[model samples]
Target: MYMALIELKDVSKLYGFGDATSVALEEVNLAIEQGECVAVMGPSGSGKSTLMNIIGLLDRPTHGDYYLSGKHVSRLGANQRARTRRDRIGFIFQSFNLLPRLTALENVALPLLYKGRSPAKRTRKAWDMLERVGLGDRVFYYPRQLSGGQTQSVAIARALVNDPQLIIADEPTGSLDSNSSRLVMELLSEIHKTGNTVVFVTHNPELTRYATRVVYMQDGAIKYDEQTKLGEVGRYARQVMYAVPETTEEDDLAGVSAIMPVLDKRGVAADKKTKLPRRKSTSHKKRKVLKK
Candidate 1:
């Protein structure tokens, strides 16, 4: 039997202590095979970020185990975890965390700097990675000079500079508009086509088209998981997108009232019971005076 590229067995993460303790992940379990593109979706405060952190080896579970490439990794020490993360995992974020002053090439080369690669080798590799992401022409542009989509492409190049086995993107297109978002997702899909194991977090139902599997989380647990064909929305997500009641002219006008609260039908009935005197019509008097 083939083992999973990533696996979590009864994993949990907690913050604080004693009465103040908060559960970010509650005995959560997940698995991803090599070359599988996965999308994780959940509402705010639903443990999606925490789960990604643990899977990416940025955090350890408070209880249970984690396996990467079939190796137990949940209990690795700080330095060991850092090394493993740098060697095997790449991260892309919503903010496109690039140094503002550095050119795109320099930013993409930053990761190779930590690995002690020679300057010439790093430059060559970074240039090639930028070309792979279709930003070869923009390699010398500063982060401030690039559009949102270009900036994120630079971030993706940086992430892949190390040739990591797994890619973890947390809201990679959150900061982009619709066109830019599509650009980023298409770039990611191209990477997936080249046999990378990719896991991304997104709240957009439409983005699920790029994923082979979709995981839905709620209340710190995986509520649903489904395999979906590429280029189509997942079944559960499709249900959610179509669940909203379609609006019509009648539906839009239903709750509106032409009368003020004092002149409302119910208020008029109460006023009649009290026998209150109604004000004479000033508009009628004005019309009579105008005729004279």
Candidate 2:
């Protein structure tokens, strides 16, 4: 049986209390399988960032359960959670989050230091990841010396340097231009293809084209969770849609027939037709709460 890479049940997050209380996430439930690229979409204050933080082990939910790779982690102590984050989760942020004073290679090597790797080994591994991300030439360049795209590439290399299985990116392309955004998204797609689970939050629906599944959120709850029909047929269709055709009618028909079987077998239509079920609150006693 297939297991979820990340799972959340009845998860909720609240801040302050009484009149000052704010509900950032309410009873949100979600599961993401390994090797899937999931894009979380929502407006500002819709709890997308909060959900990412909880998944990344930076924060704990106020209520309910969270399981990462089938291990219950919602209630783990701070130090334990920190260790889990270091070992199992990788993070990418909108601002790149690279240290201003550190070179691209040094920033990528920082995580390995916590794993007790020797300085030489850490530097070597960091160099490999930077090279993988097309930053080999900029390894010694500080963040200020690199362009915006190069900075983000370094951040991506740093995130993957630790070889974590789960990657969480929050608005990774928000600060980039169209060309830079395309580069970042393509890099993320490459990462997902390697069987690592990727979950990112984005406000742009156009970016969802690169994701296998899209989860839409509203009012701190999931409103829609649907798969993108980007199989062989869909990809071919997209290519044909963009390219001016030069083939004859018979050749086009033959090409269509060749891909029809894959489309039928994959049931692409059914996958795109998912709906979120209405959820009812089980408890009305909101005045009091127990601390986790």
Candidate 3:
């Protein structure tokens, strides 16, 4: 029987202890098959990052089972987990996470260094990956020299250098402008097309068009999950994008105006009670003094 590429059962993550405990994930269960493009959507503090961390093996769940490639991994030792993470998963971060001192080629080659690849082989593979991501011309450029979009492309190249089966991106375009965001998402979309599993966390509803499925999370639980067609926004996400009323300057001013009376009733009245009396005209006295 076949199994999911990634699976989580009864997963829960908690920080602190006793009365101070804060829950980040609450019995969250999820499964992703191979070659699926999944988008995890939620507000901040909604456990999206926690879930991604667990899936990426950067963090273990406080309570639950995790299976990667149909193998139970929840209880793996730290070293084993790290080894597995390096061999099976690729991560793209919003901050790019590239070494500032290294050129684009060197940064992309860094991951292969961990696997003990020879310098010559690492250089060849890294250069090929960079060329694949349309950054061939920038192989020797430092990260600071690249634009936001180009920097992210280099990051993408680094992620793909390992040829991992799963890609986990945490707000990959969070720090990018609209055009750069689109470019990054397109690169991710291309990766998805090549039969790699992709799971990304995003707040923008419009980006759901690239996802074959959308998972909406809230309060550390999966509130909604749906399979969506490519090139269209998920139904739930569409409702969220369009259902909210827009606010205008006039509306904001009206709201402020409505609250002004209450503010005046409390603050203005107190200020008036503490107000100082105005001084009588000193100009007249000065004029008389000048005449004298």
Which 10-residue window of candidate 1 scores lowest in summed lDDT?
253-262
In order, candidate lDDTs are 0.81, 0.77, 0.82
Cα lDDT of model 3 by residue, 39-145, tens digit: 99866778999999999999999999999989999999999999998898999999999999999999999999999999999999999999998999999999999
Q: What are the per-residue Cα lDDT tens digits for candidate 1 across 127-234?
A: 999999999899999999999999999999999999998999998988887678878888888889899999999766667879999988877899788898786565
Top model by lDDT, which number? 3
Ranking under TM-score, best-scoring first? Answer: 3, 1, 2
Instruction: Please provide the root mean square deviation of candidate 2 (C-alpha atoms, Å).
Output: 15.0
| TM-score of decoy 2 | 0.78
For model 2, state the Cα shift of residue 146 in Å. Answer: 0.8
Stretches of model 1 off by over 4 angstroms after superposition: 246-292
Candidate 1 vs. true structure, TM-score: 0.83
Output the worst ten-in-a-row residue range by lDDT, candidate 2. 283-292
